[model samples]
Target: MDYYAPESLSEALDILGRGGVTPLSGGTDFYPALTPGGPRQSLLDITRIAALHGISRQAGGWRIGAATTWSEIARAELPPAFDGLRAAAREVGARQIQNVGTVGGNICNASPAADGVPPLLTLDAEVEIAAAGGTRRMALSGFVTGVRQVALKPGEMVVALHLPDPPETAVGAFRKLGSRAYLVISIAMVAMVLRRDGAGRVDHARIAVGACSPVAQRLGALETALIGARPEEVRVTMANLGALQPIDDVRGSAAYRLDAVREVIARMLREAGDG
Candidate 1:
């Protein structure tokens, strides 16, 4: 196998623009998909590229580099609104996977079950994509088109993810239902962010559900319904969550996943409100 480890993001993007190269971050997903005679001709190791690592606070929000691993996110001291992401980080896999599996890799891979997407979606995060020429920011919701498909062009690489500063009263929660507690793919997962006014009434809310369709989806209808309603009204709004599409797979049936979505969202909203 041909291997090229670029020292900088520009070099890496140039190589990717040349075509026939697969950009690898942590390789947790790439390595497993490799077969004896796979389509990948060359391995572009972006991990050595210093520009694609680390996390920092930006002017309007926070930026997490594409190479930032789940382990790093799990250990970072971030705001309370990021608690859902931190919780999802711990559930990405076992310790071994967490050490090498990156937030960017997970987002790029675009799996419906990707543990990072729901939380990132709830945060209304934007993905920064870089190419040989320049960089562009795209909303996280628009970046993933379908299962295992992203909006990235062949030459573009995800540089970092930017999360806007959450509201002061915002609190969030994440929950996943799987066959077992650890090392199991999620059947259904929910990430919720809720902001309460000084009067303890819900002021704003965002909820995203994952592992139930080709892409994780934000519950916009439910979010809209939560407005002007107290936390006690959340259960009624969540009942309409059956509108989401889920499918039967080896892990679970569509019917079960749909049911779990409503239950999980309700629970997460209640918890976020209570905090």
Candidate 2:
């Protein structure tokens, strides 16, 4: 297999513009998808790009470079609003996967069960994509079109996951239910971010669920319901979960997923605090 590592985004984009090159970062997903003697792809490794390797504040929010690993994210001194993301980072895989898996890779892989998605959605994240022509940005909600599908066009690669600044008082929580405690895919997962005024009323709320839909989805109904309501008064009705399209598999039944989500949501609200 041919391999080329570029030291700059422009250089990488130039190579990608020529076409027929597979982008590689941590390869946590790429390598696993390959079989012995399977078809080989010409790889353009972007991990060497200096610009694509840090987490920093920009445009009043935060910029997490495409090559930044989960370990880096989990260790970064970010605000309380990012707690759900850090929690998701810690649960991405085992310690080794956490050490090597990149958020860019996770989003690009576009797994329905990707732990990174729900938290990012709660953060109102945007994806920055780079190409020889320049760059473009899109909401994380629209970037992952479906299971294993992303909106990236030919010659474009994800450059970073950009998070918009959230309410200073907003705090986040993440919960995933699996048959086992560690190293197991989630049967259902929920992430929530809430900001309450001094009067102890929820003014802003964002809730996202994964493993229960083709893509992790924000619970707009639930979010709207929480607004102006005290945390203890918050309720997740079946109508609130109507947006998720969970399918029955080995993890759990559809009814079970909905039931679990309600429990998870209640716990998450409590963790974020209640009136």
Candidate 3:
């Protein structure tokens, strides 16, 4: 019922440290998921905190503030390796949602179909968390524990995402399959970053899939298999996708998701490796 928008990180943390307060950002997900006539909860809006609002260069890579909007990410002049992430940013929702929905909210919500997670997984992103005690960092892969779940401890909040420097030659791509092209929940999605050597053999590969499992998963087997293969020779089999565990849902069947992921991976390989 009560809404508090703090101007500084310290102020926000102070409020968050007290139990029973829900941290709110853009509320793109919060407002929609609210139960009609449910008990009201106090809100601590973090959007006003200046520390959580930009994309800046860090020691070894880039730091994307938690409060950074999808629109900001889509428009930022980032590197080729970030192309997939930027593309995913544009696909987050409608223009209005993109203008307000933030990076932190998307991650904290921990939805399997979240467009941002796949690209971030491929980038080997790290989540930065803040608490009243101190700050800590963890791999994005480990941060999202399951569908609609995360590893945030009580009193802790995600502050930013850190991406390590990717190979200079790396290029990234994202592909999504849904019932509709826009404003639809994905049935299967793939994101990948690839780099070719002078001889045109894949030298680096990072692939991830979303919407087919509890948490978005990195295709470690596929990445390893692609290491010495040419872009045109890339092949993905069930063996290479051992990490996925797609389930049957109203949107699609588990078998359909696996098949769709294979097709999407093929497209992503060509786009990221050939482009």
Per-model CA lDDT versus the true structure: 0.87, 0.91, 0.91
Among these predictions, the greatest TM-score belongs to 3
Q: Looking at candidate 2, what is the lDDT of residue 201?
A: 85
Per-residue accuracy of model 1 over 1-275 as CA lDDT, tens digit each: 68999898778888889988888889998888879876756889988877788889989899999999999999999998999999999999899999999999999999989999999999999999998889999999999999899999878889999999999858778899999998999999989888888777777888888998789998888888888777765664335674468989898898888877776766666665666
Q: Which parts of model 3 are misplaced by more than 4 Å?
A: none
TM-score to true structure, per model: 0.96, 0.97, 0.98
Name the lDDT value of residue 272 in candidate 3.
53
Off by over 4 Å in 1: 236-239
Worst 10 residues of 3 by lDDT: 266-275
The clash count for each model shown is 0, 0, 0
Tens digit of per-residue lDDT, candidate 3, span 1-275? 78899999988888889878999998999999889899899999999899999999978999999999999999998989899999999888799999999999999999999999999998999999999999999999999998899999888999999999999988888888888888989999988888899888999999999998999999899899898888768788999989999999999999999998998888766665555
Question: Which clashing pairs does model 3 show?
Answer: none
